[model samples]
Target: MGKLLIQGGIPLEGRVPISGAKNSTLPVMAACFLAQGETILENIPEITDVDVVMEICREMGGEGEWLERGVIRLHVPDTISCKTSYTLAKKLRASNLLLGALLGRFGWAEVALPGGDNIGTRPMDLHIKGLSVLGAELKIEHGYIRGGVAGGKRLKGGKIYLDFPSVGATENIMMAAAMAQGQTIIENCAKEPEIVDLANFLNAMGARIRGAGTDVIRVDGVSELRGTRYTVIPDRIEAGTYMIAAAATHGRVIVENVIPTHLHAITSKLREIGVRVEEGDDQIFVDGAGLFRPVDVKTLPYPGFPTDMQSPLMALLSTVKGISMIVENVYENRLRVVDELQRMGAQIKIEGRTAVIDGVARLSSAQVKASDLRAGAALIIAGLMADGETEVSCLHHVLRGYAHLEEKLTGLGARVRRIS
Candidate 1:
């Protein structure tokens, strides 16, 4: 909808607050369907994706509104629609979560195939397999994923083993299994912090779940769930972005409102690169004015280097000395940002899923496009380090994930402004 014009060569120095995790908030909003009453969710980020979820909830006969800044008051009636329209569902990848929540609540659900960033093919097979094991007769009919229990029977709990520990699959199955008739055990589950947040919120709403932060999770089905207030964890992806941005600009920054443990992978990488990283109880300080070294990064499931931070990390590596390699073990097309970075004088070569980057002494300013959410963050970081003004287009993708991006960067003393 707009573009960000940023002047480069200024070291940012200030405090930046991380928002509530978008990954956590979306699934938690879908999980709210299982509870029939007013559920107050605090620490909600004011992002467009939240608006999309609120719209989807209303379309399904649930009512929600912003009670105040960073707060949402949602009320789900006893009876609600079990189908989500393609127009709404296709706007967000997280819409697939409705399949499990609706099926768990009403034994029937019809949701369109999801759409979000076109990084690569993110199959729904894991989600389908996990739900099928729990006794939901799901199938892809026409364009929508539709089906449920055949005989008006509640979903029966069973054991499921995911070949890949997909975060979405883990969350969908967990929500559906929460209302099943017996205990459900999911082995090889994703152990992300967002998964733990979802489990905590569900447990607060009277669902019995344990071992959430581990590879095996146990969910004891409950007859019904009541509404409750819950706060989501801070977004580690956002926190990592700011941390990398500080290092890329040679700025000293303190990122607040974060769980230091959730960012272990990011902090470890920065330290290995010779950046000064100091961790506090709930914050992290990064000093970037030091000699930089090269390091290799490979994306993996939780507790590993997150794919979301891959682009931003590459942006930092582009300015380092020597050669650095990045292997994209998560999404195949996520390296699309390489073309834009190359326009700014970066030397990078892609071989299959791996990127071999040769550090450049400096990057000149150039006009670039943001192909996706994280890619946009990478471009912004590149702009902050370049010699002149840089214009970043495709602003909608950036707005979808980041909240108050220009304001936050400006507060850090960077010259950033939004233009149409």
Candidate 2:
């Protein structure tokens, strides 16, 4: 593992370009397997998760090569192994996505149970239920999800209603239904920008899908999908993290290469907290010199405050004038960062799903460990605003999502470096 040493009290000022959405890239890469020929994906983030996905793809007989710094070309074969080893599948949670693509293409898949950040109980019940509804027989055997169509028949599309708007389940069902026999309708689907990107990528590859950024999505089963070039959307979560970092340090930063409309919830919440946000065509300029105020935030589905941004925003709220209440409705253990932040002198209380934070004037540096990806990001923001040096361990979690995090922070005038 690596650690980051950050000297605090620097007002970050510069332009920070956001990378491609990691959430979008993973599902899109998995969807590429459903198509024949070559698929060129642009603006792919250089993260550890993506590398692991590429490795999994290669293991399944797909050839993936980096065309450029942020571009990848994947060539899918007509036939591929439907089984993924436990060692590869346990690398990241997105490994579950392969089940959908493999089941769609070959009508059978044997994938090991996925593993990811120890945030909470992220079950695969929705994924299994959705695929089972589409005429695929699914069962768990020896910690592997074994699924296939009975009688060697093709999947027949059907209606699927998710108990919750699970992003992984939505993406998995959509990909599996793309090659099914008939029409598939998904209700209460995830409407995040990443879902829309995946839908667009599938459409570009000749899959008939509609209502992507809405509550209901319809997919018309096609005979086969052909490869095409597609560009991914900007990482809104990463952009929101940088914006929160700027505000926490009383800095000015321009986060570029983003979809301004996709970040309405984050921008509006920051504005309500007394941060000046200037929106442009594809960028947002955040000025944090104004007076900061406490604001209540609730993490919900898209179009609401994202659960992914909850931690970083909490770090900013720690420096505000009064108390701020955060309700994390998506993940149960997202408040794991609260303990790390409290070590730096921030007063926070956790009661079930809500966290009541009483802002302090300033925080003192302390050594902390990141328990998850977003928690690691929150610690970075806290370190940038602290009095002295702060050391953050568990760098692998941060690297799994953010691309060149230390370099980006250093470019924005924050004193950050990685130590092995």
Estimate the lDDT of model 2.
Answer: 0.93
TM per candidate:
0.99, 0.99
Q: Which tens-of-lDDT digit does each residue in 282-343 have in candidate 2?
A: 99999999998899999999989999999999999998979899999999999999999999
Candidates in order have lDDT scores of: 0.94, 0.93
Model 1, residue 351: distance off in Å is: 0.4
Candidate 2 error regions (>4 Å):
none
Number of clashes found in candidate 2 = 0
| Tens digit of per-residue lDDT, candidate 1, span 330-414 | 9999999999999999999999999999999989999999999999999999999999999999888988888889989999999
Model 1 regions lying over 4 Å from their true place:
none
